[model samples]
Structure formats: C-alpha cells, structure tokens
Target: MKVLVGADIGGTKLALRTTTPDGTVRVDVEIPSTGWEAAPVDQAARWLLDRVRPVLPEDDEIAALGVGAQGCDTQEHCAHLAAAFEALGVSAAVVNDAALLVPAAGLTDGIGVIAGTGSIAVGACAEGTVLFAGGWGWVLGDEGSAPAIVREAAKAALAAHDKRRPDDGLLSELLAHYGVADAPALARAVNDTPTPATWGPAAPAVFRAAASGSASALAVIDDAATHLTALVSRLRARGAVGETVVAAGSVVLGQPLLAARLRERLGSAHPDLTLRLLDVPPVAGAVALARARYGLAGVA
Candidate 1:
C-alpha cells in the first residue's frame, strides 16, 4: 500500500500524520522537537525519516511527503530540505511552518499568520513565490508573539517604575511571575534570560493584568495587534495574493482579547481582507499539500 505523509515541525513539537490517498488516516502522533534541527538538510531528513519509517506498516511505502518546518526561513532552504528527502528516496515538499495555516484553513492562496512563542506572516504570490515578514525571533522582533508580548509588557512596567508612576497591576504581575521583589531585579531577571522559553511562559500574566484593567497591559496588546496587522500589510505590498488571512498559534488562538483586537485592526486597515482563525491543526495543511503533490486531491 502507498501512503501519504505530512508533518508540521514547529519550534516546540512535530506533529506527523500518515494517510492513504483517499484520506484515511493511518497514524497520527506528535513528538517533541527537542532532538531535531531543521538545518543541514541531510541530517534533518534523516531525523524525520527515522520517525516516519517506524510509523509505516511493513508493506506500506510513502508515495509523497510534505513538511512545514519552523526554521525553513527561505525558499532555497525549503527546496534544499525537499531535495534531501528526495535523495533519501522520498518525494517531498517543504515550506515554512507559518505557510501551513492557509491550507490548514482550507484556503488555496492567502496570508498565514502565527503568533505563538514567536510570530510571522507568510503568503505566496500569483506566480507561487512565497513571501514572509516578521518572525525575526522573540529577541529582535516577532512583535505579536507570546514572548514579544511579555517582553513589551516588561519594558512598559520598568519604564513606569523609572518614572515613579504607581503600579498598574502590570508591574506587580511581572514582579510576581518572575519571582523578583523589585523593579531593578525585574529588569535583571528579564535581561539575563532572553529566550522564548523564559518569556513566553510568562505571557499569561500580561493578559491577566489586562483583564484586571491595567492600562499598560492593554497597550501592550494593542501594539501587538498593530504589529501583526503590519505583517499582513507588508506581505500584501510585496505582491502576495488572496484576500483572506488565516491566523493560528497559542497566543492568538488562546486569547480572545488578542484575537478580537487583531480582527478589528485587520478589518480597519485592510477592508478588503478577511481574517479567519484556523480551526484545524496546521499539520492538516501539510497533508493537504501532500495530497496535492500526489495528485490525490485539491486544496483550494
């Protein structure tokens, strides 16, 4: 039997799905990405093949494989990875993880935005050229991502402290979340460990402070929405096609407030665009791509 395989490799985890040509699922599982790296095409292909091989029945062979990987930042990188898989005897298609949101939402051409631990917007032109914006990472950019939200909130809180302003619950939330007693320590704690794992986990406190009516927290969220919207606008200007923007990821999906804010902003800024939240896991997009590649079904 021939099988189609699809995988979504995010910063934290890899979700793999195996199915027949007619779309009957045979295997579905998620594994941590801890031991995996997206670079060095040969090694990455081997790492993925190692996981995929075990999931296949003895008689089953992979007819087509598709992958959306987090670190596939460029078309060349994606092509290289695909080539690596092909060299291993598996025909493959590869794209940036954010690109999965559109197909996962059942759209053919559109913008895909992710604002989880990090954030990025991806789209393709009419000629099938992929475009990307943001996703610099939690440190420099990724403004709408979880860690970026926390990073901005911390900066706002620290600035307020320096100005001798009263705490607005935002500062207190950060202090408590970081287990620091004062503003100086808070700065030290945040500055010393600049990573998504360190700051993203503390993002909930920003929303909590916002829920409690902290002006600073609300401002942080507002800025995040603006940044996210900007990502779409940038892609559009770069000749990205489609009017719909499919958004997913932990922060945007989990926080209704951020989602609402983003929706409102996107509507106001791009009246021609429609914002849709992805209901299916992004791995579905990989599967859709695989199906298309194997001439089994169409996605759009």
Candidate 2:
C-alpha cells in the first residue's frame, strides 16, 4: 500500500493528512505552526518529516506530498518548499495556503477568499494570469481578518470611551475580554502583543457586542465586510471574473451575519456570483492535489 500525504500550514496550525485513492482519510496529524513563516526552508521540511514519519506505515512508500502554507505566498517560497519535499525522496507540490480555499471548496477554478488570522484572495484573470489580493500579513494589511477585527474593536471601544460616555458597552466588554482595567491599559496590552494568535481569538468580542446591538461593533463588521469585498472587487477590476467565490476562515464562516452582509453587498457587482462556504478543511485541497498530480491510484 502507498501512503500519500497532504498538508495545510497556517499561522496557527500545521495539519497533515493521509488519504487513500478513493479519498478516504486514514491518518491526520496536527501541530503548532509556531514561527513557521520565519523558519528556514530546511527547518520547515525537517519539521514536517519529523512529525509525519512516526504516524504512517513505514512499509508503504510516500506516493506524493502537497503543501499549501501561509509562508508559501511567494513563488520562490513555493518552489523552495517543492524542492525541499521532493528532495525528501517524494514528488511534491507547494502553494500559498489561500490557494487551497477554492480547491477545498470543490472547484477546479475560482476565487479563493480566506479571512482567518489574516485575509487573502487568489484567482486567475481573464487572460489566465493568476492574481492575488490581500495576504499582506498582520502588520501591513489583514483587513477583515481576526486580528484586524480585534484591533478595530479595541479602537472602537477606546473611541467610544473618549466620547465621554464614562463606560460604554463595547468598552466594558473589551475591557473584560482582555482582562484590562480600562482603555489606557487595553491599548498598552494590545500594542505590546500585536500578533495574530493573540488578537485573533479576541475577534469574538466584536460579534458578541454586535449581537447585543452595539453600533460600534456593527460598524466594525460592516467595514470588515467591505474590506474583504474589496479583494474580490479588485480581482473583478482586473478581469478575474470567476464564477464562484469561495469563502473560508473563522471571521466569515464563524459569523453568519458577516457572511449574509457580504453576500448582500456583493450582489450588486457580482449578480450571478455563486458564493460557497468551504465545508472541508483546507488541508483536503492539498490531498486532492497530491492524488491528481501523482496519480496515486496505482501507487497505492
């Protein structure tokens, strides 16, 4: 029997799964993606080998491996990863983690929109040139992402407090959520640790505030949806008019209201757009790529 593996390496999680030719998953492995984007190419490869080695059957050959990672945003990064894996005595394919969104949603071609720790959209233009938007990371631009939402929520809370409300609803909620005493303390805490992992989890505070009719929270959501929409709009402007636009990630998927608002907002531009929420984990896209690329049916 052959054992083929696929991986989705994100900012928070590194997931690996082995699948049969029939697409039956046999094994799944997950590990922390602590500093993966900063790690050297060889270090990342060794990280994968170290974890995946002990899980699958040693007798079966590695039919193929495909990895879609947050760090593999650049073509050079993708090629480096591909070389590193193939050097490990297996054929490999590597791509940006955002690229996995469309395929994971069961589309051979479409726009892939991801809004988790960060946000990015990938698609091909009319001339078949692959185009990208967002994915600028936390510091630069992760609009509509969790960290971005958290930052905005914090700002909203602080702004509300500055309006001399004494103690506003969102301000209180954020203060409690971050375990901070007040706005000043919250600002210090946020500025101190401005990482996706830290701020991403706090995004729920915004939704919670919105649920209770917080105008500031609702505005933040509206702005976030608009920012995310701009990614697709930019693609459309460039003539990347894909029929389907698949959305994944906790921000959009975890919040139904955000999804509805996005769909409503998009109706004007993409009237015939087929919006899909990714049902399967992004790692499955890598598995599919491995199976098709390597023709794993006979190998297994």
Candidate 3:
C-alpha cells in the first residue's frame, strides 16, 4: 500500500501517526521533544527519524512524509529538517506547526488560533493563500500562551513574595507546583534548569483559580483572552476569514476559562464568528496537505 507519514513536533511532545490504505488513522506515538530545537537541525531530524524508524514498513512504498513543527516556517528550517530525515531514508516535507491547524480544522478558508507553550493565529483563503498574526515567539508575542501567562503570573507571585504577603492564591499554587518555596528559588530554577514545558502545565491551575475568583489569576487570564482576541480581530479586520475560528493547541485547549473568554470576547468583537476546537492533532493537517499536494489518498 502507498503510505504517507505524518509527524507533529510540539514544544514539549512529538506525535507520529500513519494512515492505512483504507483511510484509517493510527493513534499517536508520543515522545518528548528533548531539546530538538537547540541542536543542529540535521541532528534533531536524525534523532526524530531514528525514533520513528521502527514503526515504518520495511518495504512499503513511502509515497510522502509531512512534518509540522513549532517555530519552523522558513526555507532554511525546512531544508535542515529535510536533510536530516533524508539521511534516515525518508523524503519529508516540513511546515510551521501553526499552519497545520488550517487543514486539521477542515476549513479551506478561515482563521486558526493556537495557544500552546506559545501562541499564534493563521488565516487561510480559498485561493490557497495563508497569512499569520502574532506567534512572534514567547518573549515578544504569544500573548495568550501558557508560557506567557505563566511568566506573567510568576512575576505577580514574586511581587507578592517581595511584599511579604501570604502565598494564598494563584501565585501560591504555581510556586508550589514548581516545588519552589519562594520567588528567589523560582528565579534560580529559571536560571538553572527550566523547561518551556514546565510552565505550560500550570496554565490550567491559573484558570481554575480565576474561575474561583482569584483577582491576580483572573487578570492574567483576562489579558490572555484579550491578547488572543486581538489576533482574531486583526484577522477579521483584514477581511481574511468567513466564519469559524479554529482554536487549537495546548494552552487554549487545556484552559477552559481562557478558551471561553476568548470566544466571548471574539463574539463581542465580531458577532458572527464561530469557535471550532480541533479534534485532531496538527500533523493531520500536514497529512492533508501532503495528500492534496502529491495527489495521494490519505496519509501512510
């Protein structure tokens, strides 16, 4: 059977799945990302390919392979990934993970918003055109992302610590979750050994505290919703969408309050907008793209 491979590389986890000839999608093979972005592109690719090699058919026709990755949009990034996979005896295509949400939502034309460890919004048109807003990485943009929210909340927690206040709310929850007794310990953790994935898991806790009426947590989540809504608004203002804003990724999906507020704020901004949460992973979109581009039927 002619088969295609689909790989989704997130900030924290890597997911691999394949489609059979009958259009059945196998469940994901989940693994840690393990600093792939910091290593040489080829080295990272080879490492990923090695992990995937065991599952691939020994003699099946490998028609195509598609990769959806975080922070990998440019040609140089694609080339490096391609070379690495090529060394592993597979021809692979790569695109930004954000863009993968487009086809995953099954919308040829609409806006896609993803709030993960980072955040980004993408717009697709019927003419096969794509546009993006936000997603400038955690430091500058990704306003509604887990990392961003955590960074902000951590600051608030530290401020409270500085004021000698009781660790009694969202900040307290975060500090405890990270196993830090105080703000200085948190700072040291950040400097010594911090994972971008570490901050992401606390996003839900922040939302829960906000839902229960923690002012500081509410403020942080409110800002996340506002910033995310602003991206959706920008896409709408540019006349880039019709209806249905696909909400994908970890942060927005995991935090119900953030997701609800985002939709509420967006509806207020544009009454006709519809929010669609993606049921499938981002790599499914890449598989669809490969099928469309290579004239294949489903992914292998």
Candidate 4:
C-alpha cells in the first residue's frame, strides 16, 4: 500500500502518523522531543528520520511526506529539511507546528490557536495567504502558553510575599515543584534555564490552586485567558477570517479552570465568533496535510 507520512514535533513529544491516500491510518507512534532547534538543520532532520525509520519498512511504497515541526518556520529551515529528507524520494512540505491545529480541528479555513509550551495563532486567508500572530517564543511572546502561565504564577506568588501576606500554598507549590528552598531561589532556578520542559509542568499547579479558590492564582488564570483571547483578535485584524476558531494547547486542554475562563471570556467578548476546542491531537493535522499531498482525503 502507498503511504503518506506526517510528523508533528512539539516541545514534549514527536508524534508521527502514516496514512493511505484515501486517509486510512496505518501507523501511529510518539517519541520524545529533543534537539529540533539545533543550529545545524541536518541534526534536526536526523532527529525526525530516526523516529520515522521504524515505520517505513512496513509501509510498502511511500507516497508523500509532511512535517509540522516546532522550529521549521522559515523558508530557509524548510529548505534544509527538504534536503535532509531527499533520500526518501517523496514530495514533502515543512511547516510551523501551530499549523497542525488547523486540520486537527477539521477546518480547511479557520484560525488555529496553540497554547502549549508556546502560544501562537495561525490562519490562512481565503486567498491561501497565511497570517499569524504571537509565537515569538517565551521571551517576547507566547503570552498565554504553559511557560508563561508558570512564570506568571511565580510572579503572583512573589507579589503576595511583598505585601507581607504570602500565601504559603502557592509559594510552596512552586518551590517544591522546582526543587528550590524559597521563592527567590525558585526564581533563580527558572531564569537560569527556562526551557518549556522545565516550566510547563508547573502550569497544572497554577490551575489547581485556582480551583482551590486562591485569589492570586485565579487572577493569573484570568490574565492568561485574556492574553490567549487577544491572540484570536489579532488574527482577525490581520485578515485571517475563518468559519470557526480551533484552540489547542496543553494549558487549555487539561485545565478546566483555564479552559472555562477562556470560553467565558471569548463568549462574552466575541459572541459572533464561532469557537471550537480542538478535539484531535495537533499531530493529526500533520497526517491530514500528508494525505492531502497525494490529493486524497485524510483518515485521521
């Protein structure tokens, strides 16, 4: 059988899928995510190839390849990936990871909002012109992302400390999670090496605290939802209108407090805008795109 291969590289995992041109799924596998951001593109390519190699022998003839990798945003990076995958002898396209949300949500024309380790909003205009907002990474952007949530939670914890009414629960939660003695030490530890894997896990603690009625924690979650909502509005302003908005992210997916707050906020502010939670894993979008490479419908 002919196979279409697609891979989605995220901060925590690399998700891969294979399908027939008619969209019948064949292989689905997930592996750890690492080193996709190295300076040399060949290293990134090898990281992808090593995982997909396991499925190729069983796939018979390969038809096409599609990749929505974490750091393959620029044309230069995409070109590098193309060169690396040339041995596969199949047509391929490299795209940004956030693009995976579009097809994952089952929309050919809609904005895809991602708020996992990072935050980004992506959409294509009717003319097929792609437009995006945010996704500047942890430093300048990714406002509503998991890392940002943890960072804000820490700040809120310290702010309570400055007022001489420190909530022990919030502060202790962060310190224990990061394995630090105090808030100051926790701050140092995080700032020293603030990778997504380091800070993303702490996002759950913030939501848990908010669920327990922690005032500072609630505020942090509220702000996060607001920031994520802004990402959608930004897309609209940039002429990326679509039938619906599909949102996905670890922060939004598992956290009821954050998700509830985000829905309420979006519902109240943008009533006309249709909002749909991404029901499928973002990696499935990669599969859909891969099947499309052969001009066939997706089975994912």
Winning candidate number (lDDT): 1
Per-residue C-alpha lDDT of model 3 across residues 171-209, encoded as one tens digit per residue: 767766778886787777654655566666777767766
Q: Rank the candidates by lDDT, best first.
A: 1, 2, 4, 3
Worst 10 residues of 4 by lDDT: 34-43
| Candidate 1 minimal-lDDT segment of 10 residues | 291-300
Instruction: Please give the lDDT score at residue 277 for candidate 1.
Output: 92
Q: Give the number of colliding residue pairs in candidate 3.
A: 2
Worst 10-residue lDDT window for candidate 3 reads 291-300
lDDT agreement with native, every candidate: 0.92, 0.81, 0.74, 0.78
Model 4, position 43, has a per-residue lDDT of 71
Write candidate 1's Cα lDDT for 152-252 as tens digits. Answer: 99999999998999999999999899999999999899889777788898899999999999999999999999999999999999999998999999999
Query: Candidate 1, which segments miss by more than 4 Å at Cα?
Result: none
Candidate 2's displacement at residue 118, Å, is 1.0
Candidate 1 vs candidate 3: the TM-score winner is 1
Order of all candidates by TM-score, from best down to worst? 1, 2, 4, 3
What lDDT would candidate 3 get against the real structure? 0.74
lDDT of 2 by residue, 175-256 (tens): 7788989789989888888777778888888888888888888888888888888999898788775688999887889999
Lowest-sum lDDT 10-residue window in model 2: 291-300
Residue 111 lDDT in model 3?
A: 80
lDDT for predicted candidate 4 compared with the true structure: 0.78
